[model samples]
Target: MKDKILIAGGYGNVGQVICSYLAEKFPGKIIAAGRNYEKADNFSKTTGGAVLPMKLDVAENHENSSLLDEVLLVVMCLDQKDTRFIEACIRRGIHYIDITASYKLLSDIEAMAGLAEQNGSTAVLSVGIAPGITNILVKHCKQRLGILEEAYINLLLGLGDEHGKAAIEWTVDNINTTFDVVENGNLQKVRSFEDGKESFFSEKLGKRMAYRFDFTDQHVLPRTLNIKTVSTRLCFDSVIFTRFFAILKKLGVLNLLKLKNFRRLFVKVFENFRLGSDIFAVAVDAIGEKEGKRAEYHCSIIGHKEGIITGKVAGLVAEKIYNGAYASGVFHIEQLFEPEEILKELEENIEIRCS
Candidate 1:
């Protein structure tokens, strides 16, 4: 009976949180899978057998794996270089949820919508905080502001949170890259950490200067929500930290991140440094028409431990996919879920305000 839930990279920081959350509800049916058997086993021991450990590498082919045969759903916590593993899961009619924020990779998987539908598999992308909650909040704004035209997403991440290597690596890698964002119904070239814009987060966070960041939410929302213009900006909780990156970008010093050693050093510094509060804030501003007049909608959420909120959101979405029947195909979180539904589940962990 394809009853097991396989979580790739299950022993890692965010994965363990998801594993523990699901294990409590589905006990003994959650499998924490990774290439490191010892680490998976060690993490499983902490669950008191509620979760099982499995030695499975997502990078390898899974077509012939007997373990995959018993898995009904696969929640990915690791970043993949290609979509072969995802194709394998869909080919077997398994439900899929990914926490990755990679726009290029997500577009590739989206191209396989026909394949997923044919195989009766449902795949949910943009399942983490920025893309996850940010996506949901924008959708809510659209709902409130009828005839939505443009939306701007601003993210504030804390330095004190325990960021995983992948997250830090991704941050460093995109420090000096160029990406496209929809503007006035056309794509415009934008550089990371450049073109600072001040955005109000909350009473506690105040207004901080946010810069262009290549978060996938901006890319997906334009097509998924049919919005003409969408942009996502990023900033740190600390005012000084946010300005430092912008200054580096303006002076072209951020280009040094292209080097492996410099990238590694920056990643290490972020991992060890704990200067700001362990808080994450996401805010969205929507412009459109309500009752034939120009109107604007605003929404925001503030929370502690970005990774935990991300894991909890993934776990909640997974539970829905596990127990309910969703349309089989590739879809972003907002396309299939209401923001109120998700925010309700996360109310205790997050502070949300909408207007």
Candidate 2:
């Protein structure tokens, strides 16, 4: 019977956390799958038999792979260059959830909605913190306002928190890049680490300047929420550290990340450096109309250990999809579930305030 949960890249940093959380509730039914069998097996042993290990690589062709024959759901913790494996999963009518923040990859998956529906499969995208919770928060703001004209998403990630190597690489690679964002109902090109905006995170973390960054939530929200303007900015918990990168960007020093060696070294530095508290924050500011008058709404969440929280969110969504029946097609987290439904599940682990 197809009753097992398969977590691709299940032995990695964030993947391990997801495996452990789901293993608690669905013991002996979670499979930690990856290309490295030894690593997968070792991590599984740490779960005390709750999480089983499987040798599975998602990059290869899945046309004849029977590894997923008994799997009912897949929680993707890794990023893929293409959607072939995802298509294979949907064709088999397996439920899928992805925590990736890649807009292009997500768009490809979304294009498969018709196929997914035809095969009776359900897929959830944008299942991580920024795109996951931030997307929902923006939706919350939209609900309060008569019409949401513009929305800004501020993300503060703690440098001291251990981030996965892939995440670190993505950050380092994008520091000197340019991406497009919707501005006034038009696509505008913007460079990363520029156009800094100050956001009030909390009492302990005061106001910090966050610069424009290509978080997928900003791209997904304009369409899903029908908002004209949406932007996502990123900063570290340490103010000095955040400024230092801005300076580097201003001087074109961050462009060195284009070199393979320099990029690897930069990733290494981030991996070894612990410069701030392990506290993460998300604040959303919305501008629109209420009762035909201009209005503003604000909401924020402060938490610790972002990677673990990401796993928890993914696990929560996975549990919902596994046990319940939803429309058989691709949908973003906000499109399928309400903001309150997600925030309530996280109230205990986070401090949430709205205005």
Q: Highest TM-score among the candidates is held by which one? A: 1
TM-score of candidate 1 on Cα atoms, chains taken together:
0.99
lDDT of 1 by residue, 1-355 (tens): 9999999999999999999999988999999999999999999999999999999988888877787988999999999999999999999999999999888889999999999999999999999897899999998998898788999999999999999999998888888889999998999999988888888898988888899999999999999999999999999988998898788889988888878898888888999989898999998988999999999998999999999999999999999999999999999999889988899999999999887
Q: Spell out the clash pairs found in candidate 2.
A: none
lDDT, candidate 1, equals 0.92
- The C-alpha lDDT values of all candidates are 0.92, 0.92
Q: Tell me the RMSD of model 1 versus the true structure.
A: 0.7
* Candidate 2 per-residue C-alpha lDDT over 98-174 given as tens digits, one digit per residue, 9 for 90 to 100: 99978889999999999999999999999989889999899999999979999999999999999989898878877
TM-scores for all predictions: 0.99, 0.98
State the weakest 10-residue window (summed lDDT) of model 1. Answer: 58-67
Task: Name the runs in model 2 displaced over 4 angstroms.
Answer: none
Clashes of each: 0, 0
